[model samples]
Target: PRLLRAAGVAQVVPPLAARDGRLHVPLCRQAGGLQLAVFAYITGRGGADAPLGREQWRQFGATLRAVHQTPVPEPLRRALPTWQEPGEVGRWLQRALPVWRRQKGRTAAARALIEVIGVRYDELQALTARMLALHQRLGERIAAGELRCALCHSDAHVHNLMVDQQERVWLIDWDGASWSPIERDLMFVIGGLSADLLRPHETEWFFEGYGPVQIDWPALATCRYAWAVTDVHAFAIEALGERDEARASSSAAWFERLFAPGEIVALAREGEAWL
Candidate 1:
């Protein structure tokens, strides 16, 4: 908060301090000695389900660029985590294996999910492999310095953004903030929210404000697929683990919209077209 203020970034919600000039204070002083901090109130309504207007979308790009461009304090820079660090790429592949396994007995449930989603078992397998392959290719580029990392709000999405009464935009939800390829943030909005809102123009507006920056197409595609697949697969796995047939089916149907044949590929192509 202090650093951004010093850098002249506008519409940021800084933490409030208590009487003792401490930024963090006890959370009710009873919840297991938990701590919390107060933040300035942002008066606006809209979320992942309800998106802000087009103009606001452009402002979102500008604000995001401001955040990424803010000079990182040396200590904070050293502490932040990055994408594809160590075994991170392998972890994504490991989590997605169940989606490609054979269906027999307990596995039948996962297979039935593939059937219900209108996707063939083989198609799901191909998608998983494609996502993993993209991850590997991008991972190599990341190692070779073709793609650069920056301070990113890893969970940046419409739901984490706010447009106050004055029409100023604010981005919240700092928990996942990290030093990562900026595409980590770009993929969520472009891949997930854009799917629901059908707002392709919003992305153009965003880029207009964000200015010019290299877009690693493969890396962006990897992020888009990996995020969706991991999330939907986790949802399905949880429901199956609990033996909640209805929820499991619901998750399957939900995931279908994301991974149905040609859907993700089309999304990736669309994003690349603009880039």
Candidate 2:
């Protein structure tokens, strides 16, 4: 509490109503006796339905850069851990994988995801295995070198990022916060933006000041493909346990379209060829 106060966030905004996750809130101050609002990042004004624009994402990148400028005090820094640390991804994976691995497609909720996977069994299988391997291997790079350590929002998708009433970019959802490779942000931002089925270079606006990541292209491409599998599974998990069969199918369709193979070889080799 003292640390938060010291950081100038006298009071956090009242947490907004969230279904899956909400990133903005209202707040007040005690010492100053001021009623004000605060945000974890730029909160967009788009209601529940609209997505962010390309320029919006460019600003998001800028805000993310600004966040990097604020040196985290020792206590906070120590308190935060890399997302790559053990027990982190594993936990999310545990809850989600069961729904993903189910074959019978009996779980009415997972029908969409199962259908997506069912169509590309051989490809999805290879991709999933490769991604798991990379995570197992490169996760060590984080501990050893802290190569791309930054305060990552962790969940960098469109839903978490909102432009508030003032049109300032705010990244919400600290629940996924961690120190990690810059690519984590990329995975959410660039990787996610790709889901819109836009051309790869179309994202140049968002990449302006962003630095390069120390990525194994083949590895990342492999991981990217792996991520498609994982993300679809995640959506499936979220959609599962629900009574809405139509919505579940909708969920699966979203996964299928987003995770389709565009050019794995090209994406894998986007940087240096994977070793």
Candidate 3:
């Protein structure tokens, strides 16, 4: 939050420090074993349900560009992690495929996901293989110093954006911040991952605020494919590996949506042509 504020981002909810002057505090293990933290609440309205107007979308684009362009000081840069190959999907495929093949689901949602997997298993396998291959190639390029890296708000979806009372757009959710290809964020905006948020024609307004950008298609394709694979792994875990009925039901719905006609899986497949 301080980094973005220093960069002159329109707005950011600064994190409040704890008694020790640390912004993040640890929670009890029973409470999920995650860190606890709080931020200065912004008086704004924003969420997945609150669709942005074209101008607001443009502002969001500019805000993201500012984040990407912010320089990381040497000490902080050394501490921040660079993007790594996504592994959850491969792990899920290894562990879950056998159970799915046997149709040994423990819950209704699990059964539904298993049934869908039974029908589309080969397609899923092929896509995972392709995504892994793309990531390998990108890694080679990065090693050869052919790709540029930048600070990224890696999960800059509509749900993480806010529109303040002053009409300025604020970016929230810095937990996923990392050093990555700029395409890591751009994939959501101009690269079809955000079809639910901005139509293709309306993306021009975003560019209007962002100015001209030279897109690296291969990098964008990798990001899109990785996103689909990661999302599938996440929802599958909830649907098949958890006992919460309501959460499982929601996960099952989201898992099905990933393969819907115009959804993330399809978008990732469409991106394969860019490679």
lDDT, candidate 1, at 228: 51
Q: How close is candidate 1 to the true structure, as a TM-score?
A: 0.73
Error of 2 at 189 (Å): 4.7
TM-score of each: 0.73, 0.62, 0.91
Q: Write model 3 residue lDDT over 148-182, tens digit each, in one string.
A: 99998888877888888877778899887878899
TM-score-better candidate, 1 vs 3: 3
Candidate 3 lDDT = 0.80
Writing each residue's lDDT as its tens digit, candidate 1 over 1-275 gives: 54665687775677887899997888885699888988887767655546567777778888888888889988988988767542354465455555544333234454576454334445555655666666677768878998888888877777787777787678787766778778887776565534555367777777787788876666676777666555555655654454555665566565556554446445654554433
Number of clashes in every candidate structure?
Answer: 0, 17, 0
Worst 10-residue stretch by lDDT in candidate 2? 9-18
Higher-TM-score candidate among 1 and 2? 1
RMSD of 3: 2.2
Residue 188: error of model 1 in Å? Answer: 4.5
Model 2 residue 65 CA deviation (Å) reads 1.1
Clashing pairs in model 1, backbone N/Cα/C closer than 3 A: none
Ranked by TM-score from best down, the candidates are 3, 1, 2
Q: Ten consecutive residues with minimal summed lDDT in candidate 3?
A: 85-94
